[model samples]
Target: MNKLKRRSDMLSKRNVIIPLIALASLMCCFQLARDLVDVEKNLDYCVTQAGKTLAQINRDSVFPRDIEKDGKRWNFVRKEEWTSGFWPGILWYLYEYTGDAKWKIQADRFTGYLNPLTRRPAVDHDLGFQVFCSFGNGYRLSHDPGYKKAILRSADTLATLFNPKVGTILSWPFMIKKEKWPHNTIADNMMNLELLFWASKNGGSKSLYDIAVKHAETTMKNHFRADYSAYHVVLYDAASGKKIRGITYQGYSDESMWARGQAWTIYGYTVTYRETRDSRFLDFAQKLADVYIKRLPADLIPFWDFDDPEHGLKDASAAAITASALIELSTFVPDRTKAAQYFKLAGQMISELSSRHYQSRDSNSAFLLHTTGNKPANSGLDCSITYADYYYLESLIRLKRLAVNQTIYDYLR
Candidate 1:
């Protein structure tokens, strides 16, 4: 009887404290609500803009590159580019949101364009990014048998890149000129592991699942610092499974934290915890989340590299990816206080991206605004990119799902 009375007292205290906390945050909460209205309006504009963009591309009778250039020019990229899947993935999200049959038709057509690539398996480690994002979303929404076969076959090809000795997939078989990184694995590879996990349970080889788990474990052991910031690359000795060194190809320096790479780690481990339900993965994700949150500016958008002295540019793609991951992360966090914090941070990121960061004036551009691609390489800096738009649409859909008390993973089911 005493224990029951104490529990009741604790519940009562929580009830009072929760409302007081909400009251304290009333202004911020009101601003967030206002931002959500803008999100809805922007999404409606995105659907129409995307439809027009697709129509123009189809009418041109040419394949499209991953980005929409200024003055309404679009480039065509080959199937081998790491960014190829993002275009179809955007169509899938548009279809998901608007429930418009035209978007569905466009998604099917665009997804079909990549179907032939699955038949000619290449050494590229980005098959997950190029195949899974398109076909995985397709199968989830449409249940098309053709999309399922494509994803499973793509998984088979991706498995061939795994080096059993190194316990991870080789990110690049070749290196830049004058550089020799033979057994290099990159943080971006973590995003690809989810496809392997999905393939294992959905009809592909079960070994794919094991390969993904091992890769993740190996990355966890080597890819992060004490602060939980991720290195862009970790070189390993293929013959001995020994560590070579951690380095950066796209970050400002070898020691600098690449913003997008950190986003990949956050999203990857959240998916890992979803697939395996491992407490270690969840705990690691939380730690990484805190590290990322601490590094953000007042707007919650991150620069291209966290350690760069000049804050001249921001990567909206990184912000979008991180926000989407946090939505899922909030659902898994066991601590109510931390869960609320994660959710609030996610809202802040989406709102910031939607408000001043997005390209509000450009109705002709199919891409989102303010994305920095490879600032270290001095290429595509502060330009709109396909993956940026893809993840932004994905994040918006995730927030919409949360509003309805649904999880993003439910779409996969």
Candidate 2:
């Protein structure tokens, strides 16, 4: 009876072990094939696209905010918009990627557009988007003191918007005439805190860092739902600095999860943790990422607003931003499995975005990707935005660095 049982067990082991070994071998081969896939060709195409974009921008001598094509011609933004710095930042990254002197020259020229912005006091919370993305990348690449000075000055300008009583940065000034609530803080302001943190670490005032931390803490307390979704804006009483209520300026509702708002929070908290090494910020980022991952579609991209059941349109900008943030967040997450999962999810989003439906075919626009920006507002719907292309290229560079066993830099700082 014992011998019969032993034989039966041995047969079972043989059946399982053989298949397991074959499966492992196949997985290894599959991974090896994926690893061997040449990314340089993809980079070449992106570089060529970028070159075309540069030529068009130069030919027109315009700063692109977003693009609109009427089939006959393409219309682009020329004002010093919030996203103006992204073009220069793209040029700097292209220079970094290809070692091209012309890209460097163009980067400098494009970066000059935001220099005036840094000197003046910022009227809105987007100084970081304008100054840091351009001069920050410039300083990172060239270590130019001029760029550093501009960034520091911009940080100083940004600090003026901080409200001590509210414990947050004022995102927008009073827009309505004799409005009851004059102070508004938005989720997007979270992305700007890095400018303050960067200034503190780089010989600017320590108060800037304190203001950033306070703003993050306040936003974490007020802006997020129990499920980690964020509100578009939180209005406050200007004189007393008391919280009025959460509102939706760019989302479907105050209760809805605005895709870009969530992306900004994830990126902001991850960066706050990176700068401060605070485990609390890491925990905050992880919770938000978990919610985002759980809610994402099979394609790993998200709709414009997670709660907008009727108008569930894709926001490529949000996906690109989230993926870039996730890749960075993966580096800091201590749980190995979770980190791997984050990276894999980011890779999935990148793969989907790289497809023809998203990638620019003819490079007619001064941008690289087609994205849904402010869909509810009917602005730049299914068009190419400069910041979307910036983050897409940024994420690609990060993935390439990982593939080549190189360390990725926090270039935004």
Candidate 3:
């Protein structure tokens, strides 16, 4: 009789536990559904705002780079500018999101202004920024033969800057004369390697791929400190190809972790790993990402310099870049727990960025605000920069795709 009573008690407990588990799972599915709906709504808002901004800038015949401190006037630049590609890239992202013909039209128009770059000599490492972001996305979406030609030519131009001895591309040609840097390569240069990697596989010289891999490997060996935090610039001996020193041009100090520089490292290595299938770059990317994640403020947005939290200024651009990288990085991670963690953190960043706290909304035509561009030089401080908007839209697209079990690279196909 006692055994029967105990069995009945156990069965009763099991019945209650089963229903609770089912209820919890149902709630989780409901929350996920709600989150996806919110993502779509946010994307709708971004597309509308981007259209308005594009219309405003269309009258000027120049790419919009950032808003002034007053937030009334825009800072526009010519196609030769490093930031010129982001405006078109933003349009490309919008077109990808909505499959709208109007965005493709605008993207094509703006991207055309950069065709001259294909024929010109390498001005700096920014050929990738000035060309790839514009024509690369253009080619990806429309598969235009002209765009492919331009990309290949631009990749060849970019390769001109890579010194075989240094095993990395020279970042600032003008800086060599002005700053006395014999061979300076900055963390920002990592983002440009994609153009070479893509070009090599797509009918360009195989040397393009070799240059990119060497650059990644060289940067990995010299750009980082023991903690995996990257320096803004690493000076190499031009003749010997030896690292001279790691220094800072944009961070608060030579030792400080520059938010954008670290963000670039995370995004760049993620791309490198994707392109090369290199486990080393993948591991390095995760380490860099982990350090950045560990040092983030409570809001998930990093300060312009990780060491200067008391400055109280946030780099929304850095957060946006990291968020986009993290989402894509999550897809490549083999461990499910780590992948989920990365995805969740990326979602949190997107949520924070989409909130009124970061969105430019009524302040300006730009998507997000409070980016600290070249804070050390006092340029573009606390402003709405173009790349911030570009990556924010990108993160949203990545998140939306992943929510549907699709990879962010699905668009490449």
Candidate 4:
């Protein structure tokens, strides 16, 4: 009987092995054969607009005195949040499309500017955003060690802020007694993990990766409610793994879903799943995506907050971020039926934005209108933002790439 059972188990394993091997082979094919979208007009618009935007950031005003040790490069003007990375990230993406040496030059200049800053080794949680998209992408494309080192150093700096007691990274240096940020915000910590993932692939230290994963897991337990709509801030006892209280910093009360915050959670979880390949993370990602899509109107653009009290202008940033996340999530899903749905959803959002939301312009208003930066707090209301423009263009580029490469995205909506 034992021999028969062993023989049956061996047969079952052999039966499934070839199909798994074939699936692995398919993934390798896509990894090697990257199809790039050749949207010449839109590509030109994005590159030119990013250039124009960076040109406006006055070196003196945007950079402090002696940021670069050699009396060269731009300096960090203030305790800028992720603002420092926007230009380089845009430049790197521009290079991805145009292969322009000028953009590379500008990116190098921006890298130089990062040398002397208030957040050299990044003091705040926004450090991930500050470098991940820019330097992280830079190192990947250019094979530059300096860019890699800068990113690695930033991770080291970020790891310092990890509080073992809370199992999360504390953002902000006691900004508010009642609300000492990242200590309060799951969203803030979520944004930083992308860098850790990048570092892990590049042979950077594991400490950063461990810290980020720990925080992500901690945030998962604390912020997400039963319905899966995540909270904006989760207060925890720093010394003990205890839930002190939670607040809806920008959401409607404790339960109301803030559109941008939801978008953030969606994007963050997408990255989380991308790094870990954990089905639980994927489940979280899909749930957030479902909530986002259900709330979408005919236009596919989302309101600033799903539970907005006042009918305000649409927030293009939240929609753009969500579109990007959907694109990323679609790549990981093995099922074609689900992949096509998300692809169509992302396509719908991008199509609407490209055709009407904003023209492929090169001037200041490169991106679409209706972006509310923290509308729940009434900040940057109804104003164009640089990061929105950058990411919007990035989403298009990624979509365009998928279209170019005859990948699953090519067949998706």
* Steric overlap count per candidate: 2, 0, 0, 3
Q: In TM-score terms, which candidate is top? A: 3
Query: Tens digit of lDDT per residue, candidate 2, span 1-413?
Result: 21111112322432322123322332333243245333455556667877766655544335766765332134555435677778888888887678778888999988886678888866789889888788988898789899999999999999999989889998876543534557889999999998999999898999999999999999989888888889899988777878889888888888999888999999999889877878899999999989988998777778888888875467788998998898778777776667667776777787777776677757454434556677667887767777888888888777666554334443324
**Which residue segments of model 1 deviate by more than 4 Å?**
1-37, 58-71, 176-178, 411-413
TM for every model, in the order presented, reads: 0.88, 0.87, 0.90, 0.81
lDDT of 4 by residue, 192-266 (tens): 788776676566787767877888888888887777777777876666767776667666577777777788888
> RMSD in angstroms, candidate 4?
10.3
Q: Which residue pairs collide, candidate 2?
A: none
Ranking by TM-score: 3, 1, 2, 4
Summarize candidate 1's per-residue lDDT along 212-280 as a digit string, tens digits. Answer: 999999999999998999999999988999998999989989988899999999999999987887889
Residue 317 shift from truth in candidate 2, angstroms: 0.5
Writing each residue's lDDT as its tens digit, candidate 3 over 157-237 gives: 999999999999999999999988799999999999999999998899999999999999999999999999999999999
For residue 287, what is the lDDT in candidate 4? 87
Give every collision pair in model 3.
none
Candidate order, lDDT descending: 3, 1, 2, 4
Ten consecutive residues with minimal summed lDDT in candidate 4?
Answer: 63-72
* lDDT (CA) per prediction: 0.78, 0.76, 0.84, 0.64
Report the candidate with higher TM-score, 2 versus 3: 3
Please give the distance, in angstroms, between residue 397's alpha carbon in candidate 1 and its true position after superposition.
0.7
